[model samples]
Target: MVKQERAARTRQALIQAAAEVFAEEGFVTASLSTISKRAGVSNGALHFHFANKGMLADAVEAEAAKAVRLITEAARAWQGESLQAVVDATHELTRSLTHDTVVRGGFELAGDTTRRGEPSLRTQWRHWVEDSLRRADRNGALAEGVSWSDSARVIVAATVGFEVLGGDDTSWLSRQNVTRFWEVILPRLAGRQDLDRLVSSGSRPSAVVPSAERTSG
Candidate 1:
């Protein structure tokens, strides 16, 4: 039991170290020896857990995918038939990317051409947003004549833009910046009657209803 626990800790440490390295140096340039050194684990141990840099990258993508799912699940659990859940999820993601190196690296690696075969967090997120907005439209949360595709494009572009910009300047991820984004877009997306129900601050109540449904794009 002790050995298993120790192995688990070591594996987690390696994943984290790899994420840090991948975030700083693109996937093509990062080296396994550097990751092992950062992880404070022997190169042999890293090979035991992950056969190569690609496998380590796969692990990082999986961890990052888990983080996106948490934000998605939390937002989906919100009580309402509105796009508020989507807005809240974007806020949560923006905050995560700003504070969590794993999440940031996952996104960075997702864009790297060399990591093509691994799961794409960017694709998954886009699908989730598209699916959620389609549901919202069917549920009457969207404004009359406002198409879900256009709304999806706007939201995805802005949120993704923020994520990219934040990499160079963290100010892009600030609460005020994200809140202002919601404020500008919500009016165009939500019906007049539903406008009052939406919050530009992207705040959600603490309650979440777990659902087993999952989506893959």
Candidate 2:
């Protein structure tokens, strides 16, 4: 049991270290040795956890995908309007991008043309956004003449843009920035009744605590 727990910790640490290295140095340039060193583990330990750099990257992307799923799920759990749930999820996502190295790295990797794989993180997010908007439409939360497809496209583009820009300047991931974006779009996206109730600044304080803090706490 102790060995299993330690192995889990080692794998997690390697994933996190790989994320940091990949985020700072593009996946193509990041070295497995660097990731292993960053994790404070020997190269043999890293190899035991991940066969190669691609495997490590995959692990990082998977961890990030989990975080995104949790954020969207939490947002949908909200008791308020569906559109409001979208807004809340957007805020949570940006918060994760800003504070979570794994998330940020995974997003970066998703866009990295150097790597190719099935259903990147960006695809996952886009799909979720589309599904959520579709739900909102069924709930009559969207404005007249607004198609969920168009709304989902715009939201996905804007959020992905923020993620790309935030790589250089984290201000792009700021709550204020996300709030301002929703403030401008929610009026056009939400139905009259929903618009009045929707808070462009998010419905609650950010629940995306840093992964390290979450694990420790």
Candidate 3:
């Protein structure tokens, strides 16, 4: 039992180390040696735990799932609140997921055609977003004429769009961009207008999540 516990800890350490590196350096440029070094493990130890870089990437994604759960759990805490509060909470949950390292990384993974069909981490994510929005719909948060599924689709897709476009050679995605996108989309889903007045454009925020959340597989 102790050996197993230690092994699991080692595996997690390697994954966390790799996640930080891969998020910062991009998959193509990231290296096992660096991951091992960051993890404070010998290269052989990382290889023993993951077998290969691709498997390590998959583990990194698993970490992203935990991050999604963090936001999902937070939103779920609003159990029986008012429709507006619930809607706002649920909207905040989606924003949390998008703003997270693992969830954002999952979007980049979903967009990668090569990685798209490979167990698609976004499958869980898509379900989470769609279901949460559906809950809001049940609470009458959406516009009277709007379809929850459609609104959910639009919100998820737009978040992905921001992740794709807002990154550059110097940075990953911007939190301000993601947050602004959230503020804009939430009003629309609720059938309210005034996106232009939410905040002035061209305002950028500091990085919050890991870059892997914004980069592709």
Top-scoring candidate (lDDT): 2
> lDDT, candidate 2, residue 115?
87
Candidate 3 error regions (>4 Å)? 1-6, 79-113, 169-179, 191-217
Which residue pairs in candidate 3 collide? Answer: 23-212, 104-213, 105-213
The list of candidate 1 runs beyond 4 A from truth reads 205-217
Q: Model 2, 62-82: lDDT tens per residue?
A: 989888987888788774449
Kindly list the per-residue Cα lDDT of model 1 for residues 1-217, writing each as its tens digit: 5998889888988988998999999889999999999999999999999999988988888888887898888788763446888888888888888877788989989879877766688788889899989999999889999999999988888888998889899999987898899888899999888889888877665422121221111
TM-score of each: 0.91, 0.94, 0.67
lDDT of 1: 0.84
Ranking by lDDT: 2, 1, 3
Q: Point out the higher-scoring one by TM-score: 1 or 3.
A: 1
What is the lDDT of every predicted structure here? 0.84, 0.88, 0.58
For every model shown, the clashing-pair count is 0, 0, 3
lDDT of 1 at 210: 22
Q: What is candidate 1's CA lDDT for residue 151?
A: 92
